[model samples]
Target: MLLAPKLLRSSPSPSALIAMGALVMIELTSACNVVRIGERKISRKLQRKGLDANTALLGEANVHYWDSGDSPETAGAVPVVLVHGFGASAMWQWHEQVGPLAAERRVIVPDLLWFGESWSRKRDFSIDHQVETLVALLDHLGLQRAHFVGISYGGIVVHELAAMHPDRVAKLAIMDSPGRVYTEADHAALLARFEVEDFADVLVPTEPEDIETLMALGYHKPPRAPRWVHRQVLEGMYGEFRDEKAALLARLLEQLDELDERPGKVTQETLLIWGEHDPVFPVEIGERLAAELPEGTRLRVVEGASHAPNLEHGALVAKWLVEFL
Candidate 1:
């Protein structure tokens, strides 16, 4: 596969700008919904594998969660919460990051309000609101501090979480995410690209067909993804079954409307992670986001992978996360 790589342009000790090393990894030949993960761990690993991991509640919709290490008792064991991207659930993003992090510290994965089993007709999916909900989740679990790992839209959630409730967050890992002010072309591209497959159109119901076509153009290897996952998510996008999406999209659009051509509040120890081959937001955006943070923030670009590096190149993503998270 053709590869592109980026490095952190900073000195660890403020004296010398170290030349960060570059690495090349394999591009898998097949599209896997999940490469085997969460198998063994010191954190509490349950049998809720795949969609089977779903948890539901009556009045307060149950949010499915996976945890490895619990900080409730241990001193050094702080939790790491991973969030997914737009139109995807937590399972879709952290299928790889979850299991490995669970090996040592507590790794918590929750399907946000709109996506997965956490679907609610009342929950707000606005970026800020979602971050608030995340913080509340931590509070509910009696966790006061945790490392946050969010991808794409999820990355933005952590940005808000760190900014709004800085006391609850310990560190941040943002991967291939869009910034506070997404440009016209960039925003349109995010909303318009849907041509990866017929079902991709169905997945983003508002414009599933467009999204499917966009995927074909955006993904380094769209064909590498299975037709079924695309189909189910696509159909769910606009299908009669996704009323939750309608409510979520409404709030999300409200968030876009509230934007004022600038990033407002921000405070957190941040690490920006990106895929060198990412066709979604690309490396430039990642570089910009890292630059916008504190002087010492880090950026790592995984070579030979695209938007969903956690899926395409999980091990590499996991390796960096093991150290960063």
Candidate 2:
């Protein structure tokens, strides 16, 4: 089930009108509908790369993904699954990566439940539920094992997936996610850094300013776009499932607190990728996590990149993934 563009019928709020005024004052009329246009272009690019937008009814959710077609070029190639983070969908987040990675291996990128087309009637928002949905996706696709790459929130999901079902994961790559190493202090600091009582206000953005703050934190060099662009992004991407996503975050925090009572280290070889100046989960967290994992676990720090190195330096991240996996 490919996601259709949302039809926003409501009138623009006071802040939105002010943003429009700024856009008009700047005379950037040609940049209207930037988000929608960008989505269409990304869809075209994925199609050109031999990836078809697809969906599978896996358990309770409909998992929407981009799959490199089963052609002769990639018939026997090992599958690689890319899971996106909280804010954006799979296509927007993994656009730069799919082309390069799919050239050598069959790449599958799925939108997590409640983020894109994937959703469920069940109220369970635990990490275990997310892992189960992903495992069901693999089973539905007839894939016994595949290399998994996850970013931020997606990284936590993949980590749990790898730990819970070792035989089903060939290798693991976690980017900017501290996994079970995330501490109570880290959570409190995150709330302080954002100056918000609830972390959901930072991750599940409600306004253009929220988006700007998220981008400033996530990117080393955040894109300089008009306020209207941020408004469009807030509406197009982060507007839906607000409460459900907040619940997911709450569950994640609870899981982090209870990590010690759960399973220990995973057996599979893991690759830990972190940004040099990640304020969300700093390099120290990555280093600590690397030590706690299996003996051969490797950590790679992308210099000058903040929370999202994969977005900041896509080619370099893709190269590392190819070498490590």
Candidate 3:
């Protein structure tokens, strides 16, 4: 079963939605009471407002984005585009690369469809549709393509984008991505994990000071997630229509069940990056992606990082990407 918080009708509020999600469970027990108290305590400690960011409506979705320091024509600078993973918005990950990468290149970070303020007009979140949305976004911005960097589930989109718009993609980078072979077992595990007692500690986040605690259960030590980042991540992601999100994910899994993981139609240049400690997809998966991708794929790993090498350890990740691309 997928976990969706009922409180999010349209979107999640800033602080209240964060704490309440931790306490939203099926079981009514004394343990839940304790969890509620803990949530409240954390909530009081970190009462945050919404994130200060810009939004551009793409189709039926609100594409939340942050522009890097320089622009394409900022006197001859290559543009870099960043895409986030599942259950996360642009603000959640890319901590290390988005800002610093902007120093030399123009960076464009947008909330992917189904995860952030962005939505799918078809109410679908398939790889094909996601790739289409990205291509449309790029066309909207009047760009052919830039350096593409994505993490975890975002890697799936990177793969699709490269396959769909090889002409648009200049260089591709994926970190600990669930790019190929999205198994049903994986979905089952995610569903089971979401219902656990300390699920919020990982998914919803219980510790205001330690936002990384949210990914404690993950393989790699989740990157250092900031409070404001969490505020935007939680609100833009997991509020309202809880049941709908769950159903949608389930439907997506069902749809992926029939699709080809190794679509074998890729032509984009790619750099595959992974963290050895990644808890979710693990490091082994990265090697598998290298084998499946079209030729000229570069594979590298970050030592201390977890699922998101770029966010957990952005500086070095940026160095590798800046050099690789």
Q: Give the TM-score of candidate 2.
A: 0.89
C-alpha lDDT of residue 312 in model 1: 72
TM-score of each: 0.70, 0.89, 0.68
Using TM-score as the measure, what is the rank order of every candidate, best first? 2, 1, 3
- Superior by TM-score: candidate 1 or candidate 3: 1
Question: For model 2, where is the 10-residue window of minimal lDDT?
Answer: 1-10
| Residue range 186-225, candidate 1, lDDT tens digits | 6556555533333223335544344455465435666544
Candidate 2: how large is its RMSD?
7.0
Error (Å) of candidate 1 at residue 243 is 4.2
Model 1: what TM-score? 0.70
Query: For candidate 1, what's the RMSD?
Result: 17.7
Q: lDDT score, residue 214, model 3?
A: 51
Clashing pairs for model 2 are none
Q: In angstroms, give how far residue 75 of model 3 lies from its true place.
A: 4.0
Worst ten in a row by lDDT for model 1: 16-25
